[model samples]
Target: MKRIESIKNPKVKEWRKLHKRKDRDLTGTFFIEGFHLVEEGLKDKEMVNEIIITEEVSIPQHWKLDGINLTFVTTEIMKVISETETPQGIAAVCKQKLAVHPLNWSKTLMIDAIQDPGNLGTLIRTADAAGIDGVLLGDGTVDVYNGKTIRASQGSIFHIPIMKGAIGKWLPSFSERKVPVYGTALEGGEPFNKIKSSKDFALIVGNEGSGVQQDLLKNTAANLYIPIYGEAESLNVAIAAGILLYHLRE
Candidate 1:
């Protein structure tokens, strides 16, 4: 174990760098805060690069943190690396391990340009709860490792495969596999329930404002929309995703 007390320390500088997307990309690692997320990282030991704890906090007796790259830092130092207003006093730096190729998925959730980190995170957590096999984050989508996203996932990020890529290039693979790919649209989309739910499918959700890209929607096996019978003009993307994910899941 290492003890770091200074914010000026080089190791602390590197740890702070994990706070940014570019740094995370360049280093091939990201930091996760909160005990649950740290626990998730610790469970997959090979993925965790380091575990950081504030000196003021004590490790739970049940934790299996033995032999890990553990570090204790001052509360001030913990604040430098933490994103939360009330720092949880624990965080972990973990290697990015998204699968290079799409998984052979029974039910996958494809997303396009979802800008809100909370929406993306909630959708992902919902997908996990619904037993979706993987989540493919298409271009223009917010970074999955964004702190708000990681928090929103509530540790579900570790439960499923998530990757980022140009969705247009990947849509064909689903078709080639004879998997049904569905897109969400505000208009000109079939009522979501019209298509009988199935065992194998990919559902592509879109930006909060623009909905799915037109070209991508055209390529899907079908475009779907939940009817708005009440005065509500729209559904939050996260809510829509929860409804659609559960409806489409086997």
Candidate 2:
């Protein structure tokens, strides 16, 4: 394995750049840290460009590294590249596996302008767990490759198909296919359970505070809202998404 000890090394500078969304987009790669994420990235080894570990840490014996590039760095260098409070001693640079075409699946979750990285990640993880066919991230949503988002996903980001684009552009395609698209809102909306679940449908969950955009909701087959029984005003967007996704899938 090649060893890098200087923070100023050109390769180290490139790895550090992966932390920024612009740089990640420019290079077509993102940085992921920790053992679980690294293992998940390795499942599709072709997407993994390189793995970096502190000199003291050993690669797991069972991990197949036949064609993978490995690098050893000093503890100080690992700290410079890590996003966590305490470095995990291992990290990897990975190519983004974004879906290029519209999803043709039974169930889909569409996110509209969700700005929180953690919430975005949790939504992706939940969608994967609920067996949703794919996740469509609308314009104004946080970047899926954000470190907090990736960490919050707990590796599910690697398990599902994710696409990014304007939510409006995809609506017509869903309409053309006769797939019912439902939006979440408290007003002018039906209770979620009242809507008949189907084998094929799309659900749109919106911003943390505003709910789905009015124009977008107008385009949905019907708008839905989970009934609130308590004094609490509303549900966190991620929790609401989990409830609706599982229900719609059933």
Candidate 3:
């Protein structure tokens, strides 16, 4: 095993760059940190390009290393490359894959420019729990490869497939397929329970501040609002998404 110590190592600098979307694009690689996440990447096999491990850690069995490179480093060196304040002993350089929707999409989630990484990730994790067919992101949303988004998703990002497109472009595609596209909003909308979501429908959750776009609003089959029981004016986007997803699941 090779040993690395200095934070100034050229390889370390290049690894740090993987945190940014621009860098991930330039290299076609993104970083995954922590034992469980790296394990999850191992499960996805093809998505992981390389694995980095502490010198003493054991590579688990049943992982098909085949042609993947494994780099070993000191604990201090591991810390230097990690994005979290509390570093995970392992990380990986994973290949970025384009998401493709399966032909049989029964229930789906559409994300529209959700700028906050935490919210987007939380919504994604929730979508997976609800057994969504796929996730679609509109333009202006945070890069799904960003470290925080990946971490917040708790590795669910790897488990569920995500696709991206302009809202105007994809909304029509859903419409053409006879899938009812619904947006969660406050005005000019029906109570979520009032509208029925079955196997062939997509739910759109928009930006933290702006909500859904007006143009998309015109094309929506239904705009949904969570009827407030208390004086609370609104719901956090992720929570609202979970509620909508749960309501639709049955």
- The C-alpha lDDT values of all candidates are 0.89, 0.92, 0.85
Q: Rank the candidates by TM-score, best first.
A: 2, 1, 3
Q: How accurate is candidate 3 locally (lDDT)?
A: 0.85
lDDT of 2 by residue, 1-250 (tens): 7999889999999998998999999999999999999999999999899999997888899888878899999999999888899988999999999998665766889999999999999999999999998999999999999999999999999999999989889999999899999999999999999888788899999999888999999999999999999999899999999999888876
Tens digit per residue, CA lDDT, model 3, 1-250: 3557778889889998897789999998899898888888887888988888887777778667878888888888888788788876888999887686534576888888999998988988999999997888889999988888888888888888888877677776787789888987788998888876577888889999999888888889999999889998788999999999988875
What's the TM-score of each model vs. the native? Answer: 0.96, 0.97, 0.93
lDDT of 2 at 20: 93
Residue ranges of candidate 1 with Cα displaced over 4 Å: none
Question: What lDDT, from 0 to 1, does candidate 1 have?
Answer: 0.89
- Put the candidates in lDDT order, highest first: 2, 1, 3
Give the per-residue Cα lDDT of candidate 1 at 73.
92
On TM-score, the leading prediction is: 2
Task: Name the candidate that leads on lDDT.
Answer: 2
Misplaced by over 4 Å in model 2 are: none
Between candidates 2 and 3, the one scoring higher on TM-score is: 2
